[model samples]
Target: MNRSGKAVIVLLILLAAASISLSGVIYYNLEKEKSQTNNLSVEISDIESEKARLEEKIDEQKTELSKVYARLEQNEKKFKKLTFSIDEEKRKSQEVVSESASLRKDLADTKTAKVDLERKITQNQEELDSFKLEIAQLKKVKDVLQAKLKELTGDFDVELGKIVIGPEDASSKSSPRIDATKKKSAASNLEGKILVVNKEYDFAVINLGARDGVSVGDMLSIYHKGNYVGDIVIERVDEMMSSANFLSSNTKEKVKEGDKVVYRSS
Candidate 1:
């Protein structure tokens, strides 16, 4: 072959080798670039996931904040209600204090009224005692007047066929004695003197009986020395004497030897 043709062939071989080398280098560079692109895509996905999580946490915080605000509003309303209740309680306490003071005044008034009633009762008791004393004095005066009238007009002894001597000496008189010599007759005065008394047997004998209009169940008021003594009821009787039992004992001294006796009226 010719020399120029050999040189051309050699040049072509060199160019082909250069082309293959360049293509291998370019392929290696392209593979490395592809690997970097894949890594970048993975990093982008991780970043997106982190951003979504952060947004969810923000929403949760917002929800918690709303709940807190609601609770705060409820606490404020409760505080206001408590203040109103305190004011109402204070007003009721004032009313209760006023009522208590009024009740205390009423109690004091009642105590005063009770003391006044006791004083009035004591005064009334004193008046009753005075009346009893006055009655006793009046009875004594009446007895004295009657005795004076009997002395002035001796008809009481002559008409009745009895004497007006003292009770101690009247028994010795012949007419007053219950003997066979005396005559039984209806008595006008219906009066008597105690002749005998049996305190152990609770009985007494008077100088008046059937003839003196004395009957069973007749009450007699007895006196000793012008002092009121007691009462007695006639239980038995004879022609000139009546037997009686004491119905009541009033004086400290029991019925005695010369006690004056008179018929009692209701």
Candidate 2:
């Protein structure tokens, strides 16, 4: 309780006050740190929940991706099969095209052969018709010759007793006798015009016939403007028309329609 004791007491009172203030500050700082630690813990918990949700969504996406990959593999297999089928179709189409071309060529060849065969048949038919016509004409000539032979035999029977055999008479009997028709045709002065001239067939149709003193095998001269063009031998005769064949040796020019034909003896 003297002066020095009073000073130490005052210093102890200040120290005590400072210690009280520092304790209060430390308590306030520890409470603030505790509040901050609780807030951080709550934030960490929320982060963990969000991370779990994201992981689950990622699993779903992986499953969907696997399904997509499976579908893509199936489509690739189908495309490969379709490509092989398309190649086969193209090859078959080419083969069909080649076969069709070959068939068309064969058909064309067959058509050509058929045309040639038809032409040959037509030619043969024309020749056969000509032969039939010649046979008919020969039959008529035979009838006429048979009738003349009958008449001559009847005449020979009537003159057989009066006939005498002599050397000069024997020669005369052996000589060939001329038909009356030939003699008449040779002396005939019949004149007529040609109606048709077929140069390809080498024949002519004349206006003269049997009625005009024209007979079969009678030679006639064809004249154009008083000049001899050719000669024709009568082959077939009608009442007003006659068909004659051209004499190749006597043809000086091509005969034409309306040319004059005069009978002449050969």
Clashes of each: 0, 0
For residue 64, give model 1's deviation from the true position in Å.
1.8
After superposition on all C-alphas, the RMSD of every candidate to the true structure, in Å, is 71.3, 71.3
Q: Candidate 2 lDDT, tens digit per residue, 171-255?
A: 2332223476775655477788877665546677777765466778988888898888878899997544688998893472467
**Local accuracy by lDDT, each model:** 0.56, 0.59
Score every model by TM-score: 0.32, 0.32
Candidate 1 total steric clashes: 0
Give lDDT tens digits, candidate 1, residues 1-266: 79866655555555445545544544553454345445645554554555455455546555554654555455555545645665667665666656545545554554555555455545545554554444444343334334434443453334333222233432332322354323222343355667666544567777676646777887888888887788888899753467788875443247885688887756
In model 2, the clashing pairs are none
